[model samples]
Target chain A: MTTIAPAVSGRRRTKSLGSLEMGRPGFAWAIPATLFFGLFAIVPLILVAVLSFTRWDGLSSPELVGFENWSALLDDPIMIKSLWLSLLLTVLGVVIQTPLSVLLGVWAAGHQRNRAILSAIYFIPLLLSATAVSVLWRALLDPNFGIPAQASWLFGNGNLFGKQATAIGVLAFVSTWQFTPFHTLIYQGAARAIPRVLYQAAEIDGASTVRQFWSITLPQLRNSMITSMILMVVGGLTTFDTVLILTQGGPGTDTMISAYYMYEKGFRNFEFGAASAIALVLVVVATLVSLVVVRASGYDKMRSTLEGM
Target chain B: MKTRFTRTVTGTAVLALGLSLSACGSSDSGGTGASPAGEESGQFHVLVYGDATNKVEKQIVDTFNKTSKVKAVLDTIPGADYQQKLQTIINTDQAPDVFFNWGGGSIAPFVRANLLLPLDDYIAKDPGLKSNFLPSVFNSASVNGKAYGVPMRGTQPVMLFNNKKVLADAGVTPPTTWDELIAAVQKLKAKGVTPIALGGGDQWPTLMWFEYAYDRIAGPELFQKALDGDKQAWAGEDSKKALTMLKQLIDTGAFGDKFDSVKFTDQGSPTLLANGKAGFELMGSWEYATIQDFNLKFAKNDLGYTNFPSIAGGKGDPNNVVGNTNNFYSVLKKTKTPKAVGEFLKLMYSDEFVKASLAIGNLPTTTNTEKFLDAADNPDYLKYQFNLVKQAPSFQLSWDQAYPPSGIEPIHRAVQQFFSGQIDADGFIQAMQALPAA
Candidate 1:
């Protein structure tokens, strides 16, 4: 009843202020951004959806093919395997990065001077473009000339890219190294925003540090976790530059994730229609995953974890 | 809180949009004139692959522009992105009047789409254009008996390159026959060196082995048949024999265990040879230039090359060669300045062109190229390639370039898998059979 009372008064206040032109900014302020988004994002997406139904190589005029591309994709063994690989890589990213970043983010959120210096050094990798990072790691892992040659006992021929397991492992490892800092920054900001009084109260209750974190810090980071996971999901689904520079979907298409497979199909094979189909599937999956995460986590309700604190 | 959530959703949407956006190439209008071949009023663009060799192309363009009223503009896309970018713009109004390509499957789609101007008329106007180049090389750009391109760059026939000092230390000589090659490999292996430095990671380097082996065992007709939609050609006895021979080479530890992780583009395999870790490498003629760029002393003195060893009873001619035939400049159908384009192409075989090409270590296919051979950066190597190309009965285009671009991935995958023992003879055959028809 108390929560509902403020909401009813807020609606009345906004309505009264609306007549005096003192409420929220009018929809006109959003027109430019809306137009830009519509032109760049919405229109292209609609066109791609239409293109998925046509059979067209780049040189020829597109012909209406109905559901031929979709049906062919459904039968494509590589497409199925690529989907599984995408899922596996995404799961690996979330599983490995979530705890790691959370801990690092919390630690970096401290007031220690040394922590600031170390975190700054840790963020250097995040500054490099994905292509640069991938190229650096590729050189470092070269079997005959790189670190592998100096430590043959540990590397054993350094066929990291020659086998499927190791190729995926490399992709996951490089991406984690490149992206963990970014998610850590998100958690760091969120951790700073967590009211310090909650900690004080927990301390007075004689709670241990780990207990305080489990009960207060973890619960308070629920919103940040959802935001970070959604980012990881989307980024993982579209992981292209690393895979291209590192493995190139090689070792007999073992690491052919969906995004790269789409590129190979569209650009290399000139099967634009099939590629568009794959692109649409990626979009739908990413959107649905994000939506489900938001819905399942009760994120849309915007309930405050500190509601009665 | 709502604003933050909205921003996150918007950000996710943007990321998803990027995937589909990249799937479709940019359709923005280019800065070039939109009018269809606006006569002599505007410049006719010439797009070539961007690389160190571009200086020769630039000089040629300047020489062309000196006399021509409809001036030529040289545009370049970086080497790696050239093919993809060309495809994206080839069908648009932004398409260049003349573009460089590997010919064969590279320009086949343009021909099928009627976007290419057949060069037969140009050849008829000036018979020198057709007769100037070697017929074996000239026919590479022809489609269905119609001439479509004029050879612009040097031929890149794959040859067996060796570390001469390493071979000498191992008491071996460059092999001339299949038996001798095997014997040499054994000696090199026994000498505690890898017999060959293969950049299997690059995939295309591995394809070279399959290309020469198939040509040796089955002749150029087999690949021609396979490319012409005869899938059974891959399943034939000749194809199996070629695959078996390649498997034998791999199993003999010819490429060593780490070949799959070494790449030629990154100086991996080349370093192996230069360091005497390996004895030989089968590579394109440009390998000389590539090695010269990195290890000049070794390239100048120790570099050795020979034709791929001949198989005794093979169907292929002993003198047959397989590699990139040469790059060609194909004119688009919409060019209004056909007269200017013809005059520009005439310069391709001019003495100046030949001299400049040889100066840069490129062996021009022009008949007059022989006269300029002595002035080349490396006269002996240039003369050897020129003589080899001149006497070769058939200059088989690489299998990847011989088929449409769609076939590249499958061909590379099949060869790489065969080398890595991931696939066998039957599996390799099936992969080849599945390639898109030429």
Candidate 2:
């Protein structure tokens, strides 16, 4: 005991000395990243906020219109509908993607050759660009000559794009298909980081495999779940390219979500002011949703699941 | 500690230097576009819609550069984003000296902004600039009786393009009157085929049906009056009659229910026609080239085109045509070398321009176009379009182009909604009446 005490004290003294010598990185260390973020994100956001208060048709000089665009947007039915649709699509994405990715991720965490091979194959859809994926699905879902024609029993008349429900379903399914692997990868990394000692203790207590998973694995994944959910919520709210290439806010604007509507107003209709207002609303909404999720999930507290252990 | 601090400082300085250098490079490049007239002396930029047609524009620019001391550099914005990018850059210092425009409402906004140069003086100096092209085509670019653009490309008149085999199989000949067209639609539909391949997803393709129906029933006067800010024209009985006829066509299932799922831009509707799933498609003359590019064998053998069927007792002349009259190049007022710009405009009527445009299956509206018709590929097709335009009493610009650019989305939405049965006749009329005047 005496010999061990002196050795432990000596190690602690060395650790203290090493830490004292190592200086913390200064503000200059963050300069490059801060500058990049300022130029690309913050500057453009400020400009968009300024433009939202003006009437710019992109041809003539922008005229300051004050609250005109904001008031008009408030009264616009399409604007309201678009907001609702954005929320619906976003919620659908989370509901469909969360459980799917979680299961796949936990399964993929196993270090089996088959699991590795299957996960690699599943990751391919995530690598393709949103444009390429939308086009590929559009061709696949075509009513006359695509997979729908071959599987008419499943898809009646295959008017998936001409109706609202099916159109939204396609958007949700396509997004889930394209993005699940990304979330799965996140969960897999977290799942692998889980302590094996907890599982061993649960097994000693006569816990079944399912019960052990429910008691330990899920609780351990709390932090990763919050991270993955926030990402999904933001991704769904800003879904644009898939909608543009697939639906084009069509079947009489039934599928017109906020992002595409903003594009239509800005690029197609040349109503820059109104579009900027819509953009700001999108940004605020995404931010608020993320904040609510972070707060409700207790993610902001930064409490570690392994704190007691 | 000092060494690490120095390294950090050096790294940041290097990063700062690199960033500033890149920023300087970008600014220098941007200055080139802005100072083309002064700093980039003896040269002007000619921006056009980027497409297969750009090859001709490039050749024309090369021809001009070979002779003139003032060189013309050709730039192209891909067709889809051309209008938006043009408007964004037009009033800025980066604006092209000469740029492509659709001539009617397309340029009206630029003209109103005083950004465009009036070409009356140039035309006065060179009578051939005014006289070389067809009067109907040239007058399209003239706003408020002042010429502002030179017709550069071929005219595009919407035609009823059909699959010859499909029509023959269905025993339906190309209709020349409204009633006969309805009968043909029924016949084709009865044969288990979509009578018309309307790319409703695109919305603009759906608008072609309305343009023809309105012109045939209410005459070109109604739309022109509407464009001239006469809202009453949309509420007129003739307007209602046109809507009724279009509604009947839609109710008859002429376009299959899934048309809203298809798009012309992606070769969806054209593929439907080529594959014999659809009997007809009313599309611009460019449809010919689009199909030819994809399925050369099909375009060569089965593609058949005819004039839009006329209404029997219509107020409009049976010979009235509606589509893009022609694409034109309008000069920016800020151009320093108006003389060099004039020399470039002169090439629009040059023999080389006409021949090159024709070889690519473009029907140039030049008076001398007929002279080289035999020399051009698809001479028969070129001659057909030439005569159709030549004989037409009024070549109404497309409703989308006749209305200011801001009105396009509303117009497309109204027509699509009407066709899809989301709105009735009254809804369509109110929508049309509410469009901002050109």
Candidate 3:
């Protein structure tokens, strides 16, 4: 017993020494990465943060202006409207795309014969760049010589969803088309991970297909749905390229997203201070939203549930 | 995971290497000092706006290099994006030693920022330069009595028509008066021919029409007053009359049904006049090269040039011309040797450079270069020069080039809106007034 105890303590000491060695290797890999991130990402972000509190015309050195840029943001109607529009797009994208992707994914998974073909078809949009998609959709949604116009003409035309709604609808549709494939892949993997025994047991107990899907399939896919939802929310919040190329925040700034408005302010008007302030606000809002979504969706609980299943 | 790590390392190494190499190259190029022999040896970078493949620009640059000590490097950017590129370079303190600059408000921002060096002292010491360049050409380059650039060429707006076709179809000669021009347009339209082909699709071309039309109606005095911030109402009766006349021309379908859709450079509209597709085109002297490229033939008498038709009740003279000097070169304030740059400018304005520019159908701004305009060599060139000097009361600068940057864009947009029927006379005037005055 005495010999075994000494040996056990020696093994424990060796294990602790091995952990210290592992920690050194981890830090060796981390130092370069940290340096890189500091140079490119952290430095630029800190610079932008500093510039947000200063008045800089992008020429000459910036002058510190305290909270003037932040105060000005309250009175800027265009920026406020753009912020609201961005939030609306983010909410709508998540609400509409997340369920559609899961349903499509589940249905595609059941059709084993054409699974590859259907997946390829669904993934076609993901191949296209945002600018290319924007151009293609811009042509498709143009008021003149566009697919929508021709369709409306056959049905008799009068302001489809009233001009403002038409723009929002088009933006949402394009965003969905671009993002659904990514979510669908996630959901398909989740669906495949569901144990076949659960379905078999439900079938033996006289549970119908719909009931089996609700009880077995959905419960299993909860973790993936949460993951896809988070991705969708974050992606939608930063939507800029498609909207920039398609509408340029036009029709009287009705389609201006926060990112697009910031670009216009910074590059077009040389209002870097104001743009940086807006960017800081966007970062804060995005962080708060992610936290709220992660907590409310019970992401950790779902992850544990999936593991237990 | 291993592949991703390798890829990230490769990307970082490449980015750092590329940035360091570019920094080294720029510093090396910039560090070359001026030679003591009044010759630039290493490189003299010139930033120009246009297609680099342009024959005329190539010939001028080639001739200048062969005759001078400087090895010229031409950087050509498209005209639409040139200002943005130039502004970025200037802001970064990486301005080219010699760069092309448009005459008026286009150069004002650079001048105001103290980015451009004043060339007045250079011009003052050179008697040959003072004698060779036209007074008005020098005037165009001067801002607040200080010269910022050298005038390369001058352009004047003129009426171009298919001599045989237009005159024969109308059953009359080219119109010399406002009434006659209207009658001629009516005659041409009756026969299903477009009288004038103005590409309203491009906003700048549409703005040119307004400038020409307004200059003919209001003359230089009142127009200068308006441009000079006199605060006189531009929506007065005279301005309304001009707008109404412009609208009347539009109503008569003088520009034809598809004028708005026609791309300015393509579809052979400019070439169409040379090819006899239409009656007349109101264009600047720059069209001569294009006309020559199409191999069009015009007798000295057949080719007609005139000012925009004057309004019967307007105060402006019919002979008044809307024109300005073209893009000119200016030396940077940070140049290591200003004398070498001045010498290079002198070489560019020499007789040989003038001849090369004139041979390409460009109007030489130099007074001594009139030798190239001899009737025996080019009768059309000589006649145009004679007509310009005699007829034009004063060469009014293109409004786009003359106004401050902030003021210029709004006027351009206002004119475009006016031509598109988005706004009427009073509304257009109000929009113009709404722009911040200099």
Give per-residue CA lDDT, model 2, range B1-438, as digits (tens): 544533343333333323332332243234222233334768898888888899899999999999999889887776476787777778776778999999999999899989999998898899999999888888888888899888888999989999999999999999999999999999999999999998888899999998888898978889988999999999999999999999999999999888877888878899999889999999998888889888998888999999999897789888888888999999999988889999999999989999999878788888998999988777777888899999988888888988888899889889888988889999999999989998
Instruction: Provide interface RMSD per model, one decimal.
Output: 2.8, 9.9, 10.7
DockQ of 1: 0.44
How high is the lDDT of residue B52 in model 2?
89
DockQ of each: 0.44, 0.31, 0.06
Candidate 1, residue A8: the lDDT equals 46
How would you encode candidate 2's per-residue C-alpha lDDT over A76-136 as one tens digit per residue?
A: 9899999999999999999999999988999999888789889999999999999899999
Model 3: how far is A167 from its true place, Å?
5.8
Q: Supply candidate 1's per-residue lDDT for B296.
A: 96
Indicate the docking level reached by candidate 2.
acceptable
The list of candidate 2 runs beyond 4 A from truth reads: A1-29, B1-37
Every candidate's fraction of true contacts kept comes to 0.52, 0.36, 0.01
In terms of TM-score, the best-performing candidate is 1
Kindly list the per-residue Cα lDDT of model 3 for residues B42-137, writing each as its tens digit. Answer: 566666766522455566667667866656666665545465456556545355777777777777766766767888778788966556666655
Q: lDDT of model 2 at residue B388?
A: 91
Clashing pairs in 2: none
* Model 1 lDDT tens row, A17-118: 787787567899989977877777777777789899998887778899999999999999999999999989999999999999999998888798799899
lDDT of each: 0.86, 0.85, 0.65
lDDT tens readout by residue for model 3, A203-298: 899999999989988887888887788777667777878776655564335677887776666654445787788776766666566666666776
Kindly report which residue pairs in candidate 1 clash with one another. Answer: none
Q: Residue B337, candidate 1: how far off, in angstroms?
A: 1.7
| Cα lDDT for residue A42, candidate 3 | 53
Where model 1 places Cα greater than 4 Å from the true spot, the runs are: A1-25, A201-207, B1-11, B18-24, B27-43
